[model samples]
Target chain A: MNKIPALSPTVLLAVALLIYPLIFSGAFYLDVGVTFLLAAISASAWNIVGGYAGQVSVGHAMFFGLGAYAPLLCYKLYGWTPMAGIPFGIAASVALAILIGIPTFRLTGHYFSMATIAVAELIRIYFGTWDLVGAAIGLQGPATARGWWDLTFRSELPYYYIFLTVLAVLLSFTYLMERHRFGYYLRAIKVGERAARSLGVPVQQTKIRALVLSAMFTSVAGSLYSVKTGFIDPESGFGILVSVQMVIIAALGGAGRLYGPLIGALILIPLQTATNTWFGGGGTGLTFIVYGGIIVLIARYEPGGIYDLWEQISPRRWRRKHAS
Target chain B: MLLLQVIVGGLLLGAIYALFSSGLTLIWGMMNFINFAHGEFVMLGMYVSLLVVMYLGGGPAAFGFGAAFALFVLGVVVYLSLIRYVLRGPMLAQILSTFGLALLLRYTAFWIFSANFVSLPQTSLSGTINVGGILMPIPQLVAGVIAILLTIGLHLMLTCTTIGSQLLAVSEDRGAAMLMGIKPDRMQALAWGLSAGAAGIAGALMAIAYPWSPSVGETFGLTAFVVVALGGFGSVPGALFAGLIVGLIQALSAFWFGPIYKDIVVYALFVALLWLRPQGLMGKA
Candidate 1:
């Protein structure tokens, strides 16, 4: 057990990302980096509930989609500042997170995941038919690349850095969650809720807080997603595939670890980039087949994910033995 | 006049929905796995039955009632291969594996059947049948009758049969059943096979009555999840009642508030039900 460092490898990873765009000047490289960063942030947020707290939510896109829509809706309907709307997105997402988490948290794994998926579909249906957000016609911006109130951007670089900051905050937060008393409560609940409750852990409160933080983090990422694309739609935000992406990312990177989501995103974005560039128009379905297959393989062999591999190789065991 | 028309049409549609929800609930109760790709099973059954229609000259009436049995075989295939292995794994594992299965089945339908929607040709029975002042479509009535028959048959099998008793015992406690000389694995396999077969029967019935695309089953699958959740997980009777309840609620909500907020009503109902009653209506059982 080597001494747990005050500054983790993740802090180093964040620093690396800050400097990455400067060196990786290629268009393809930039695209991959930005995509991974944004998705990684959202996946990390998902980890708070799905990974750390031991809950699986398929309706995560509700928060993500709401995050995308809130800012866009504010811009379209009320002419609010983009930065200001982010807080509103975070607030709405938090409310939804609590609304969903309070009840569905009672469900263990698949049922809970299924509940989330159903909620996402319900949200999608509402958005598709509702007239408030332009209904099925969808909301389009008056202009693009204007950078007014941070509603649009000239390039993807600013958006990348924005998500990178969110990722750093979340990674640091999750690291602390691993060490805090609440973290243990979450793990215990994940292991067995009855036993955890018997041991005096405030199970419901802990789960809800974890989800609240998760919603806040994911919604911010959604806000960035809309700004990057300068468009908002029901399918893009609340799509079932987006929920699947979080599951795959968390599983791939190794759920419950601080850096697992980022590792998962790094692995997936490159594959997605390759598939997108190679297959072009018709490759979409095949790309998903490959995407889903990766998760199946991970579930079968490396259920713990890439983090487990690193844990096995590192001298942390020796350090622990030495300490004992 | 429109009010009368909507109510009649909605009830007829609700009956069609009941057919899909029954199998979904049965699978949930017996196997403790909600087959996310259940809709695709329904989709494949439709295509298979469609082929039956094409081969036997024309129309579902050619096979008449035997079409449900045809779906039974496909269900057994789905069970023996994919589902049997994934049972009793982690919740995430079970869910994702089935979701993968759903994805595979849906995409396969996309490629094999083309993306085009398919339906049986209209006949005299296809039009609305009038009863007193109320008019209901003939096909929906047929679907309603078949769903009730299947539901009753399932109830008897679950309660009275030797295999059904074994299924109930294993679902309650697999380890204890194995200790008592019952083969838990074999029982699980049978349960899965039976559940998949139900999905097939439901699918065949759906295609016989409702027009279908490769993805149409998805709508029902999502709703079936809501129905199962609301009805209480693993309670077929609860699902039957809940399906009708949700069906009427959705229909009435859509009629009054417009379709825009219809799903919100169902979702709100689910959230409230789960909050107020976590074990579900039958969770106490």
Candidate 2:
């Protein structure tokens, strides 16, 4: 028997992702794929600060909502192509991250998380009432493609490619970050703040930097979401559930690992989509039950998440040398 | 005259906030654990009250006690099952575990109850009381008084009771408490029970006056966190003072700036407060 060459998992995943649209030719599956990539993008972005820096923000949806609003706002108000608003979304998210991070980073543990929630909720409430963003009525993107720049594709295939490319870039960036000194600084901060400061890690600055980068990418993910969905609302874009999903997804895959969120999105999005499809609106309860169950199980059985769980169960020789 | 009415209304609401928040603060003080599902416990309390009224044909007192008893048992069960396991886990695990529990509880409620908003059927606690030209709804007045009494009662229990000391001892130092012959597990379980019972009573009280759905927990939960933080974690008396203040602010803001903006005002103040006094009003430096 000829032994099949041992291609690395990363390469295999990449190959599979690149050809996913071709294999899953149906619109439904392609849409699911796109949704998965979008979720992965946001979760991975969240991982930058939440996973690596160990600051568990429960209000990242504020940035995602801001990003979602930008593109839709541009289309609605200025009649400009939604893509033109991506930079503005990124800018707003970066600025808000700086504004929120400076003060919130002072808090530790649950205090920090609660502060984020308060701030994000405040923002969401403001946006809901603010007429410029269309108030509670929300904003809509292009109904139909005004031009090629409008990105209103009839098929989900284009979005799959677009989102896949974004995910690939984000993952690569995270991979590079893992090897960089900044990544080390983040890990140091995560281990313990006072200790990291004692070791001259510039703890506050490092955290703020991670948050800014994280917010920028999270904003991009939101913008992409609005582009695909062609609408943005306070509830859909800025809800607490949005923030929770990101944290849960990142946690589920083994936070701090490069592929953790990707793995999380891979499992969770399909499951959520399938449940919603099969059971309709009533399935929402089941979805939430599943999410809650997963969170409790992971926290109880393996806080390191599925990745660490696998590492523990896998054969010694098969385990990666530096699994963590 | 209108201002006085608003202030009175605010205080009444604040009393309820304090009642539930004391439970949250108790948990934090005892275990340094934030129960993300504290709101769910309150939600369950409301449901328990509703069921008591619906099936048991109970009055306010009966349902209130029923809710508290149900939630107290639930808190103990939760402590024994999920919380005990994650207590030693990473902060991430600790946070997410309760969060998951919150989701599970919330959605399970949704599945069982459906998503419709429900109110208690006409009970004996109906009508309003005119107090010095300010008409206070009977339910609100009664709920407020009961909530205040219960909160103070809880505070006194902690300071005066043997069980209270044991709970506090475990919280202050688990190893030392164990050396002193106190079973840390039992005390912690009791703390959870007491904490959840308070939340349950608050929920039951609120159910008498306010129409609610399963999702009401999120609002109450966030409000409890704000109250706990404002009052300084682990302080029941602080929760009382802070709850009253928050309730007043919310009422005044809503009256002045429309109801929609009230939450914005509360949260803005909360964030600002966190920045200025991260230790909170009564928290130890």
Using DockQ as the measure, the top candidate is 2
Clashing residue pairs in all predictions, respectively, total 7, 0
The global Cα lDDT (0 to 1) of model 1 is 0.74
| i-RMSD values for every candidate model | 2.6, 1.4
Q: TM-score for every candidate vs. truth?
A: 0.90, 0.96
Quote the positional error of residue A120 for candidate 1 in Å. Answer: 1.5
Clashes of 1: 7
True contacts kept of each: 0.32, 0.86
Candidate 2 has what TM-score?
0.96
Q: Give the best candidate by TM-score.
A: 2
Chain A TM-score values, per prediction: 0.91, 0.95
Candidate 2 C-alpha lDDT tens digits along A255-298 = 88899998899889988998999999878779888888998998
Runs off by more than 4 Å, candidate 1: A1-12, A107-111, A141-151, A309-324, B1-5, B54-87, B122-128, B179-181, B259-262, B282-285
